[model samples]
Target chain A: MDIKAYIILSLALFTIGIVGVLVRRNAIIIFMCVELMLNAVNLLLVAFSKMHAMSGVAKASPYFASDAQVFVFFIMVVAAAEVSVGLAIIVMMYRNVHTVDVNFLNRLKN
Target chain B: MNLTTLVFILLSVMAIGSAIMMISSKSPVHSVLWLIVVFFAISGHYILLNAQFLAIVNIIVYAGAIMVLFLFVVMLMNLNAETEPVKNYRLQLVGVITGGALLLVLVSAVMKIDVEQLVEMKVGDQGLIKVLGMNLFKNYVLPFEISSVLFLSAMIGAVVIGKKDETANQ
Candidate 1:
């Protein structure tokens, strides 16, 4: 397993997600971009979990090797929750303003 | 060089390409579809890494549930046509520039890391559901239950926010 390659791939995906969040104005798309970022992190963590499992020091105990995988599960749970709340917020925004664009959400400004 | 490496490269290309298209696509629905492609590619990677459990969950949670949620919201908004508002070039340029800089910095840092004592992969069944379930239920039970609470709160919050107020209707 070329760990470097996995890391690079994960990083590239993360970068694409960053660009998506930065460039998009649509609230739903922006939320999707955040999900993309979360998936990227999940991929990297899985790769690291595999790497740790392969290392010699951790050969005896397999539990330490798979800890990151469990962490990824929690991340997925949090992401699911976030999606529900975020979509609801976007829905509420649409109901009040009649659009899902984030540009009109500058009411926090002075 | 080997088959696994080749497969990894192929999946990586698919993932990155779909991701780029997801952001650049003119329609939000298309973006969601592209994002699904990316998720599938990532799931393929998980399979390649021998993590079948995660790969399945990725498909079920992300592509099945979350993406359908996105599509439903888009459909509800009546944004079938290309209706996104146009923004100035400066904001986009700034976004692109920042993203590019972040990529460059992270990639360079990644390349500099030297792994002198890396071990060969054992191909153990660590990614299996049985092992992960035991670990999750035994050691990580608290976090798991707390996450359920988080989900409950999120469900309530979504319902509260999405429900139409009767006072505003009249």
Candidate 2:
């Protein structure tokens, strides 16, 4: 597949994620949008890795392509950890505030 | 178009459309479902790109564990379409415009790249588990081990934060 096509697709996904984060009032939804953006970047990284391995320089290094995949694996690990903590925070917020709205989190403003 | 390109287009459409639905859906449960669709599409892309290990991991981790966690939290809070908080339409419009502008700039920049490389698709062995496992256990072992510590900290932090305060009720 053309690398440009992959880039464009990833860009579209990332843009949707950004819009979701900006537009949604729900904190959980916003967090999910962050996950969307992370996945988009992960897709791009994988695409770039394949592209690099297809080129001439990768001949010297056997591990060049696998590096990106390994990085994506670690990213998933971190994302899992992040989601656990973030959802716990959100759950606590909902428990205290009784709503998932991000606007309600403005108590510090006062 | 060939089969690879066709599959690529299909997965891209599925991903983008599901992502749009995920954000636009009124119900949090529905949004989580749509996000699962997005994750599936992304995993399909991974498989097409011959990153088999990442593809499976994406499905198991994102679609299985993380999304289930999201659904559990959403359901536990009793969040639904009727209870969704309303934001200003003007703010939403502005956000859409801003995101669109960013997308435009990025797409334009990406188009300017002169290299027209083809991604190595189903033919590559670099995405195989054996290759990635060796690489992970070799030079990347330190980061991998440190991530375990991070997970430990995160688990403890979540437990600490979610615990009920005994004194506060008194």
Candidate 2, B1-170: lDDT as tens digits? 89988998899999999999999999999999999999999999999988999999999999999999999999998889999997899999999999999999999999998978989989888899998988999989999999999999999999999999899989
Interface RMSD of each: 1.6, 0.8
Q: DockQ numbers for every candidate? A: 0.71, 0.89
For model 1, the superposed segments whose C-alpha errors exceed 4 Å read B116-122, B168-170
Looking at model 1, residue A18 earns an lDDT score of: 88
Q: What is the lDDT of residue B152 in candidate 2?
A: 98
Deviation in angstroms for B21 in model 2? 0.5
Q: For model 1, name the residue pairs that clash.
A: none
TM-score of chain A of each: 0.95, 0.95
| lDDT measured at residue A36 in model 1 versus the true structure, 0 to 100 | 93
Task: Assess the local accuracy of residue B133 in candidate 2 as a C-alpha lDDT between 0 and 100.
Answer: 89
Report the Cα lDDT for residue B45, model 2.
Answer: 95
